[model samples]
Structure formats: C-alpha cells, structure tokens
Target: MATVFITGESGTGKELCALAIHDNSARATGPFIALNCGAIPQDLLESEVFGHVKGSFTGAISDKPGAATAADGGTLFLDEICEMAPALQTKLLRFLQTSTVQPVGATRPRKVNVRIVCATNQDPLDAVRRGAFREDLYYRLFVVPIHMPPLRDRGEDVIEIAQAALHRFSVEEGRNFAGLSGEVETLFRNHPWPGNVRQLLNVIRHVVVLNDGGLVTLPMLPESLPRSVQPPPAPAAAAPTDPASSGYVLDSLIGRPLAEIERIVIEATLARFDGSVPKAARALELSPSTLYRKIEGWRGA
Candidate 1:
C-alpha cells in the first residue's frame, strides 16, 4: 500500500488532514486509528505502536492490538513520527516493508493491510540529516508528500474560517454575535497567524465566551492581539470641499446624532491606535481619564 507524509508547522492541522485522507479513501468504512509518537514515553512507545501480550513488560497486563493491526483494512495515522526513537525505527521499517505486524514479545509477525499516513511538524528530510529520523523510513513513507502552508499564507480564507469558528463557538458558549467588525476583519487579514487555524479557533472561543451579542469590535479583542496585529490603513480622507467641514471627513457624519458621531470618531481613533485608549485620547486632544469616562458612558448607554 502507498503511504502519505504530511509536513507543516504545529497547529496547522496536519493530523486533521491525515484523517481527511483516511475518510475519503476506499477504506473509509474501516478503522481509522491515530497515534502521537512524541507524546508517549520512549520506553513504551514501541509496545504502544506494535502492542504487547500480557506481562510482556511492566504495564502490559493483557493482550493489546497495536495501531497497525487494529487499523487493518483501513488507515494508521502516526503524528510526530519524527520523534520516534532510531532504535525502534528498524522494527517499524520492517513492518512497513512487509504488510505484517509483530507485537512486542510476540513470537511471529501477522499480516495486516493498513495504509500508513504519518505527519510531523518539522521537516522529515532535515530530521534524517540530523540523524533524528531514519533515511530509509523517510523514503518509504514519503510516497505522497503534503506540505500544509501556515494560515498567514492562506489570505482572506482566514476571514471565512474565523467567521465559521465564530458561529460555531457562539452556539457552544451561548453567545450571540452578528459577526466581526470591518476593523476586526482588516486587523485579522493583516495579522501573521503564527499559530494557524487552531489559534484562530481559540481566539474565537475567547471572544464568544467573554462578550455577549453584536459585532466583535477591536476593543473587545484581548490586549495581546493588538500588540501583534495591525489593522489596514483607512482610505485617504476626501479634501475639504467646504471650509466649515474642517480637515475631518464629514460625509458619513452629516445626518447622525452628535452622540453617535462622537462615538464613531472615538472608536475609529481607538482602532487606529490598536485599541489603546491612552494613545487614542492623546490624538483626540482629551485626557486619558476623560476618554475612559466617555467610553464607559457609551458602554452603559
């Protein structure tokens, strides 16, 4: 059977991609088992993958079907395969060479038809060069290579993805949100999402749990976000056609109530300053305390 190898930064959903492959394959109805090699103890890692009979080693109290055997006629997804010890790699390579599984302490190997799909957050070839991963095993499992680009590279897909997460998290947390504000969308688009989709989901979860209804505004975002994320530049203001309009754009403020107009100006300035009220206040020619009082009044109103 052919194998698939996925490489991506952590939180880029490599395992999720592996599962998707398994689900879409001809063996979709069969078992789809996954193992995170790095999470298991080094001593018991072999036994965990290949299984062990009763009393085979310290905690092997009963017979166990390893991932390879249990996933027979289906798929076996090994995450962080690069973390597997070099010594145990031989046994794993042997199993891959022959569609057979030999459990630890077992006398003989048994045949099993399982498609191998493995992933690592690091470069598998680099691991081979560093002697962390076996060269032959790398070649064996790299039949189909999948490189999952980080979220920052995915462009406006982040907007749709965040919205989807927002909707799902909203229902789960019993929070109702219309959607992200235009400023938030611009900020999200400009941000370099180092943590990918997982990070985006976590942020949506945080927002859904903390705030109630309405659009997710810049001020509502966690403070840590503004430091790393910057919003897109606003359109250049139209030249003053009327001397009465001053330097500020008055097109959007014409029919609005004074309170609403003030609120818009304040919030727009806050967004420009990455949600820093201190900086926004300085720009607006008001004391920080005065700005805080006004914002609090708006919240209550």
Candidate 2:
C-alpha cells in the first residue's frame, strides 16, 4: 500500500482526512490504528510502535502488541510525525522498508502487512532541511501529499460548516436555532477564521448554551472573538485600500494626534464587532463603562 502524507494547519481536519483514507482503502474492514508519536515518551516509543515481550522493561508485565502489530492488514496513522525523535525515525524507516515488526525483547522480526498514513502540521521537507526529521523517511512517505486550506479562504464553506455545527451544537444543548442572522452571516464571511472549523464549533457551542432558541444573532456571540472581527465597508469618499489586497497601512498615523489615533482604533474595533461596545471594550482590554464614556465624549466633541 502507498504511504500518504497529510499536511495542514492544526484543526484543519488532518485526522479526519486520515480516517477517510483508511475507510475508503482496500483494508477498510481491518483495524485502523492511530498513534501520536510526539505524545509518547521517547524511551517507550519503540515498544509503543513495535510491541514488547514479557519483562522487556521495568513496566512490561506481559507480552503487548504495539501499534504496528495491532494495525496488521490495515492502516497506521502516525500523527505529529515530524515530532518523532531522529534515532527512532531510523527504526521506523527500516520497518517501512521491510514490512516487519521486531518487538522489544524479541530476538527476531515478524512480517506484517499494513499501510502507513502520516500527518504533520509543519512542512515535512522543511523539517528535513532543518535536520529535525529524517530526509529519507520524509521522501518515503511523501507519496501522497494533501494540503488542507485554512477556513477563511474556502468561500461559502465558512457559512455551510457553521450552519452544520450550529445544528449539531443546538441539538446537543437542547436548544433550537434556525440558522445564522444575515448580519452574523456577513460577519462570519468577512472575518478571518484563524482557528478554522474547530473554532467555529466552540463559538456555536457558546451560542447554543447561552441562548434558548431562534436564529443566531450578534448578541449571542462570545465577547472575546472581537479580535477576529472585520469592520464594515467604509464610505466611498474614504477611498480605502483594495479589498483584494487586504493590506493595512500605518503611514497615516505619523501625522495624527495620539488621542485621534486612539479614537480611530476604538471606532474601527467597535465597527468590527457591529458596534457592540462591550465586546469591543473587552477586546481592547478596556472596561465597558470606559468605552461608553469615550464614545459619548467623541459624540459630545
């Protein structure tokens, strides 16, 4: 079976992709094993991947099968693969080459058939260049490379995923939400979802838990997400930067007064959160009353 490499930003569903590969492949009925190489202690990792015999080490009470033996005739998903120690990587490479397992405290190796699927949030080639990962192994598993794009760049998918998550979370919380309000939809579409689908889920969970029912409105959103908020369209006379460029210029600040700059920043932040002063205040680390007083002062001026 061909080894597959999945690379993407964290929370972009690498594991889900790995599972999909296992499910659709020829070994669909066989056991699909997943192992996080980085999470296990380095000393025990060899045994974790290759099994161990009785009394192999201090904790070895009896013969135990590692992920490799456990995943015989199926797929073994190694996550955070680049985090694996260099020394153990050599052994892994050998195992991949021979299609065999040499359990700890065992004198000989046993043949096993299994497909390898690995994932890393970082660039594996870059890791090899930095000498953090084995170059040979990187190329060995680079047969199939899948890169998952960030949520913001996926067009209407943001809204679609949000709607699905909303329904799921609403049912879990025993609340009913028809869908997102138009303003909330625009807010979601315009904002850069840095945390991707996982972030959308938590936000929906917060919305579901706090509110009883109805469409998801701005007021139901968490106050702390203001940093990711995007401001509304500017006036035509302002002549803002091209939307495609999404570039922010700091040159105009050179000649502006400090108070004016602060006001500008506050107003921009407020607009991003749809004029919700409390959410903006929390994002700017200011008290709500302080934000209120500043806005009143700005209007009074």
Candidate 3:
C-alpha cells in the first residue's frame, strides 16, 4: 500500500488511475475515500479535509470525521491537489509527517493509519516553484509518481478506444449497429481529439442515440469536429481501382446494406469537396441534378 502521485493533462484519466491503484493494493478491502480539493470552498476546505468539532464555526453542528479519518484503515485519494490553498498545504504536510490529524478547535491530535494517493493535472514542479504548492508537501506526496499520457501521444490507441466506446454505447442503448463504417473508422483514427477519450465517448453516444438501424456512417457524425481531426478522404483514383487491391470490398462495407453504403460514399464525397455540390457532382461523374437526386434518395432511404 504505497502512496502514489498521479499527474496528467486534463481528460487524461487521473482519477481512474488512482482507483486502479487503490483497487489493486492490499488496502482494497478497506474504505476508499476521494476528495476534489478544487470543488470545495477555501474557507471550508480545511474542515472538509480535517473535520471540525461541534460549534467550531457557523456550519459546524457536530463533530465529523474528515476524509482522512473516514479512510483511517484504507486509502484517501486527493484529486486536483494543485488547487489546495497554501494554508491547507502546511496542515496536510504535518499530517503526512506525523500520521496524526488535528480537527478544528480540537487540542489532542488523533492518530490515523492510511495510505495516500494524490492526483493533479498541473506540473507539481512548477507549482512548487511558484509558491502555489508547498515544496515539503510535494516531496512527501511524490514518492511514487505516475504520469498518464495525453490522447495525442498515445498513437493508435485512439481508434481502439473509439471502437470500444462504440461497442459499449451500442450495448447500453440497445442499438444493433452493423459495425463501424470505414469512413467512421478513418475519422476516429485521424482526429486530434483535443478533449481525449471523454470527447470521443460523447460522440459515440450521440451517434448511437441518433442511429436508426445501420452502421454508424459518416453522415451521422457531428459537424463541430474540427476538419484537422478528420482524415483526408480516400483518393478518387483509389476508389475505382480493383476493390481487392484497395482493401475496400463489397463485403467490407461493415455489413451495411447497399442504400446505407451509397449514402456514406456520397456524403464522404461531398465532405471531400467541402460541400460544393457542383464539384462533388463533377467528381462523382454525375450531373448536379443527379447529385441532388442522390441526396434526396439518401434522406428517404
């Protein structure tokens, strides 16, 4: 039951890492308490971390156990530790050093035996230098540091995460989506994903909610996803080449029926041309009226 400090950028899943560690540790059977330092007010934050005695303040109605006391025989996870007030840092440091807590308006310190796990989304070194975080506390909490990489740095994991999220959303929504369409796969793979897995989960849920009864095609995707996030469309020359050579066979349409397949192809083409009907029609070797007719057909189908 070693203390750990997890740090990463926003959306990198620091809290998840903390839970994984706690659940895997020997203290798994004990209580697992968590607190968000940034969510509590500065005035009441100390009382929340280290409980106050009755009549200690305006809101102190009874002697309550703080997060530390609540996890006496287990783990106390402090998330967003960088947001803690400077005054609280000294108190927390003392507790970490002495393994004892002094509740507000209480003279005697109560001993506690608990493992600590702290998480933050900022650079602790920078915080310590800037005086926003205490150096002594930082050293005490930095025993076993674990860093989570951002979505961009995780490479091909993006597509894997999207597929997993899509499957989960499908099961949860009771939707029988054929599978992920090729266009959808490309979009998920190429996106920069600034919001990371959280954003991808939302997009997958949105698609599952709106899907009628087929694969999640490109047309179902949100319009707000940045162009930089979407992969460039397959080259026109590649589409007409031997299907086997290009790895796009009729059977590889992800079990999508012909109508859905055609719609996906046309929508992807339109997007490739930046929504220019004339250019899309010319590129597809169809008349403008024919392109309009195909759109109407797609909508109806």
Candidate 4:
C-alpha cells in the first residue's frame, strides 16, 4: 500500500481528503482511523499510537489496541504529523520500514497491514531542513503529495458551498432560510476568506443559529468580516501642490463635484501606478476589489 501525504492551511479539510482517499481505495471495506498528533501530549503519544499492555504503567489498567492496530486492515490518518516527537518519529519510521509495531512495555512486535495517510499545515520539507522533523521519516510519508487549494481562489464555488451549508444548518436548527441577499452575495465574493471553507461554514451556521432567517443579509454576517465590498469614501481635498507641475490645482478640485473629484483622483492614481489596480488601490488606501467596483460603476455610468 502507498503512503499519501496531504498539505494545506488549517481548516482546508485535510482529514476529509484522507477519508476520500481511503474510501476510494481497495481497502474501502476495512476500518479508517484518524488521530491528531498535535492534540495529544508527548508523553502519552506512544501509548496512543501503539497499544500498552496491562500493568505497563500507572494508567495501564487494561490492554488497549492503538490506532495502528485498530486500523490494521485499512487506513490510519495522522493529522499534524510534523508535531510528533523525535523519538516517536524514529519508531514511526521503523514501523513504515517493516510494517510492524511493538506495543509499549510489550516484548513482541506484531505485523500490521495498513495504509498510512499523513497531513500537515506546515511545509514538511522545510521542517526537515530545520531539523524539526526527521528527514528519513519525511521521505517515507511523502510518497504521494496532495495540496488543497484555498477557498478564495475557487470563485463561485464559495457561494455554492455556503448555500449548501446554509440549507443544512437551517434544517438542523429548525429555521426557514431562503438564501443569501444580493448584497451578501457580493460581500462573499469580495471577501478574502483566510480560513477557507471552515470560515464560510461557521459564518453560515452562526447566521442560522442566531436568527430565524428568511434570506441571509449583510447584517447577518459576522462583524469581523472584511468590509472590502463596501464603496470607498469620497476623496477629500488636500493641501495644494505645485499646480503647474501637477496640472490639477487643489483649489480647482475643491469647487468641483465630489463624484468628479473622486473619478479624477482614482484615474490619476491608476495612471501613476502604470494601470495596476492593486497598486493604485494601495496608494489610494482602498481595497483592490472596492477600487475595481468603483471603476466598473463609473465605466457603466
């Protein structure tokens, strides 16, 4: 069986991908076990990964099968694999090399036939380079690498996923929800969701759980969300520069309409930045999407 390694940012569904792999593999009928290496204490990690015999230690009142033995015939997914201690890493490497596990305080080693799937949010190779992770163990688990894309880059899929979550959470909470409003849709599109799908799911659940929703609105969204979809503020008149060199006099801009002045300043900034919208937005102290939306509105007008 081949080992699969998954890499992505937090909440990008690394465990979900691992389950998909196991469900589609030849070991579909067998058991699938998962453990978060970073969530367990370092002292107890060995017993958790490999069973400890009775009377082995203070808490060893009974014999228990560890994750590797429990998933003997199927898949064992280890999330945040890089967080494993160095001693555990060496033992893990030995298990991968020989397909055998020796339980803690046990005299004999037992052979296990199971596929391994490991996932981490950090760069495994970089961890190896810094000596935070074992180089030999890295090679063993890095047989097949899969990288999950962040939600912001997935375009309309964000809305689709959010809508699905809305429907499901609404039913679970006994709320009648229609869908998102036009303004909320625009907000979702412009939002750079750093937490990916998990953030969107939580937002939807938050809306459903708190309010009896008909249609999700901008007010229903969390206060922490980025306000990039809102229109930029009107440009204010600044101190006069050399009118002859700048061409546009500050006094002239003062008497002009707000819309006209805003257009002139935005266009001038865009031109100054060589037609780069992001650079222009940075110079104007506005979000790139907000600047683009304003320019698009001006064009349509």
Candidate 5:
C-alpha cells in the first residue's frame, strides 16, 4: 500500500485502522511500529524518529536506533503527524522521497523498506492552508487518505458497539453482565458522544468497575454525560381531583421515601409538558442534564 494518511476526531480509532492495515498487509510478519509525534518533546523528537549515535547529543549516552530504523522492513505508524515540528517535517519528507533515513550525529544514511501510515485529528488541508503543516509533505502522505467518522453519526451502530464493549469489559472485570438496560441504550443512542468510541469504552468500563453488574444502567453512567440526551420520564399516577374531598388524600405520599417522591414529581412534571424534557426541567427548577440523569435512574430502576 501507499503512504496512508488517516484523519478523524481524537477517539475515532485512526490508529486502530492503521494497525488493521498493517496486520493485513504483506509486512504482517514484520514489526508494526507506532510513534505519537505530539506526545514527544520537540527537542528529542528527531533523535527518537531518526536514531542517535552515542555522542550525538547531551543525553545520547549510547547508540540508539530510532522508530524509522526499528520499523525497517515493516510498517511505521505516525500519529498526530500535524504536531511534528517544521524541521522534522522537512526531514520526514526527505526520508519519504529517498526511502533513506539519516540518524542524528551519523554521517551515513540508512535505507528502510517500511510503509508509512500517518494520522492526525486535524484536517490536513486546513492545516496546510494555515501553514501549520507543509503542503508538499501533506500531499506526499495523503496518498491513501482514510477518514473515520465520529460515533454519533453511526446511528444504531453506537448501541451495537457499546453492547460489544459492555460484554468485553464485563468479562475482563469478572462480572456477570446481562446487557444494557433499555434506558441506558436510549441514552447511548441520543448522547453526542464527543469522545467517540474511546469514551464509550471508558463509560462501559466505568459501569463494570463501579458496581457488580447484572445489566448496565443509567445511574451507573458517568456524571459527565450530557443531560439533554436522556429520554423523558414515564407518566406518574393521576393526582386527586379535589383538595377538600374526603377521598382526595393530601397525605397519600406522607410515608413515601423522599427519593420516590422526587421521582414521582419529576415524572409528573415531565408528563405535564408532554414529554418535553427542557420544558419539564425548567418547570421543575432543574437543569436539563440533571433531569435527564434523574429520569435515567428512575427508568433504569
């Protein structure tokens, strides 16, 4: 395959896609090396990607082969390519053109037969236009561009993926997981999922780790999840028609638990608004997200 450029939001599995490409390529038996350009300090990046001789720099105590050399005869996956410094970009472009790498403090260049797979969360063309990335280098690596869509656009696929994650995490955590509750599934479907699959995986893992699981429930979900995503609460029992009537008992909920009363009131308010969550929330003097969480818990129960 040609030099592959993968672009997507942070949690869209760009690196995972790169790994799949490597695993299915002719170099499957060879090593699959990965480097996160953004994670490394700028000063040490060159040496890390191009190796260094023992006396190359202040911290170069011994001869070291860099990622490019390590990935020889295999696949080299570079993540956050846009974060690479300009100087490093030039060096990378040269290496791509000549199929050779010049290690730090080394006079000689070494040849490597490695497939280049790069990824970035930013749009490369936009970065190029902004001059944050080199245009020529962008074109060179954009040979086989693959864009992974965020999870929210995948519709029901979100639930499918989450269910799989739930099962896997349950097994890993040694819990008897049945599955997600219906309310949890609806929440998953409606959630914007800003963190994508990575966030979903963590959510599932959080649920599994925090409680002994029978089924994943809304209360088990993280507090950070948005409240607008939750479905409106179920309708409450009808109120008494007359306040002064002997049958109209004002003490009907006298012995009810505070939590139960809260649930009933919230549900009734939600029903009064014809299932309009925001309207119900405003009427109930609660934030929409708070209402969502409360309703999620009630429905899950």
Candidate 6:
C-alpha cells in the first residue's frame, strides 16, 4: 500500500531515492530487492521479475523465485523500467493490478505482497506517447511519483557529494591527505559535470588511486574537469567611481552569459590555431573533443 515511483536523469540518485523510501516505510525491517530492468536479457528479464518453474527455459534446472517473490513483505525496486520491452510492460501491469504473478510455465498465479518502487531515466510521458511504454501502466505506477532533481540542478550538492566520495576513497586508499585545496575547489565548482555524482565518485576514486601523498590538487582531477575549468578573469576596475560607467556600461557590453564568454574564448582560440581542434585544445588545455562538444552545445542552444 506504500508504493512509490521515483524518476530522474541517469546518475541523479534514483536508486538512492528508492532505498530512502523503503527505509522510511513501515517495511524497513523487511527485505529490499532491487532489479535493473535493462541489465538482463529480455528473455530472462521476465523470469527474473516473476520467477520461473523448472524447465521454463534452457537455463532453468530448478524452480526459482524471482525478485518480486523474494521481496514479499518488503519493497521491490524496478530500475530503468523504460528499458523493459512493450510486451513485458503489459505483463508487469497485470501483476501490479492483482498483486499476483504467474511464473513462466506455471499453471497458477502466486500472490505477491511487496511494495513496488519503479524508477527510470527516460521520460515516462514521452515513452507513452511513442507507444513504447503503456499509458495504462504509466498511470498505474505514477500514483506517488517523485521526480528526483539531477546534480546539475542541485548546485552546491556537487561539492557535498564530491567531498563525501573523496573522504570515503581516501580512507579506503589509506591516504591521510586533507580534502580538496582552494584551487581544486574552484575547478570543481566551475566544471560542467554532465555525469553528475557518478563522475564525481570516479574522479575521487581516481585521485585516491593516483595520490602520491594525501593532497589532491587540480592536476589530479580528471582531464575532463581540471583542463576544461579555467579560472574566471580578474575584475576590471574594482569599485568604479562612475556608477553609470560601472553598472550600465559593463552590463550592457556583456548581456549574454558566462557560458557565452567561454564559447567566445574557445572560438577565438580555435581560430588563432587555424581551426585545428588539437592545437586549439592544447592551447586551451582542454580535450580536443571536449572543446568541440562545448561549442556544439552552445550552437544548439
């Protein structure tokens, strides 16, 4: 009765949300089973979810209880639900409606008493519109939908997650170093982390692995981060005497955005290097393709 549906972009902590809900619910003492709908083969996916009788398929030597049955009296998390095939979606809907599952090659339906928590990176509405996801199933699972915000939109959470990961990795790596330095903090704040928390985790793990001592400097950061995050220019004429000159004039000249400024800088560097991506990237100390992708994103914007 305490089912929930969590949705978010990849690396946006969808599974974490599901776990949190399960932990908070009355069934905290019960089992919490998680399934990645996209990881297993489609043929085996159904068997994994709804169990299978002996001789259900080639690999089945004996009857096995799937995740749903195993999670009875607890919570069952279905991750990447959009990745499930259309036919399987219908079958899942049937199970959801009746709280019963018919194992493959089984003659009778077995009642399941587990809270369902579904998650997906893909947009459910879009998937429904495309006829890839069942509209009825969408409405069924969306009863208590929770849209988890991505790390990019969470602003300062990036630093929080990074620090946590760094601490965990540092302890694991047996390094006694302090956290990120001021310079590295600046880079961490500026870099557009498209991969979000997972990328931060990877960077922290990498730093721990590459740490000569306990210090994680800007250089220790991934090439995707440190190389791309250049420092902002120094303020020109700090505290201008003329209010008109300081406020309106400066603001008027640069009305676009900081991203636009970066784009211009990259474009200028590319032109100065005669459109040689490698040379321009080297000059800017960014990956050649990273620079190109930034330009492409700007253009598309």
Overall lDDT per candidate, in order of appearance:
0.82, 0.82, 0.79, 0.84, 0.83, 0.78
Candidate 1, residue 169: the lDDT equals 85
What TM-score quantifies how close candidate 5 is to the native fold? 0.75
Candidates ranked by lDDT: 4, 5, 2, 1, 3, 6
| Clashing pairs for predicted structure model 2, backbone only | none
lDDT of 1 by residue, 1-301 (tens): 6899987778888888999998898999999999999999989888888888888888788999888889999999999999999988888899898888889889988999999999988657668889999999999998987777667656789999999999988888788899999988988898867678888888888888889979999888877776346543442332345677664567767898998778777877777776666678679876444565565466446
Candidate 3, residue 25: how far the Cα is off, in Å: 0.7
Q: For all candidates, what are the clash counts?
A: 0, 0, 0, 0, 1, 1
Residues 57-84 of candidate 2 have per-residue lDDT tens digits of: 9999999989999999999999999989
Q: Which candidate leads in lDDT?
A: 4
Q: Indicate the residue-level lDDT of 95 in model 2.
A: 96
TM-score versus the correct structure, for each prediction: 0.74, 0.74, 0.72, 0.74, 0.75, 0.75
Q: Candidate 2: list runs displaced more than 4 Å.
A: 231-301
Model 3, span 97-161: residue lDDT tens? 88999999898999999899998877687788899999989989989987776665466787778
Error of 4 at 292 (Å): 24
Better of 2 and 5 by TM-score: 5
Instruction: List, residue by residue over 57-162, the lDDT tens digit for candidate 6.
Output: 8989999999989999999999999899988999999988899988999999999898999998776777888998999999888888776655544557877888
Prediction 3 TM-score vs. true? 0.72
Judged by whole-model lDDT over C-alpha atoms, candidate 3 comes out at 0.79
Across 1-301, the per-residue lDDT of candidate 5 in tens digits comes to 5999987778989889999999999999999999999999999999989999998889889999999999998999999999999999999999999999888999999988989999988767668889999999998998986767677656799999988888887788898888988988888887867788999988888888898978777778888876457533347753544657535444766788988878767766766777666678678765444565455455457
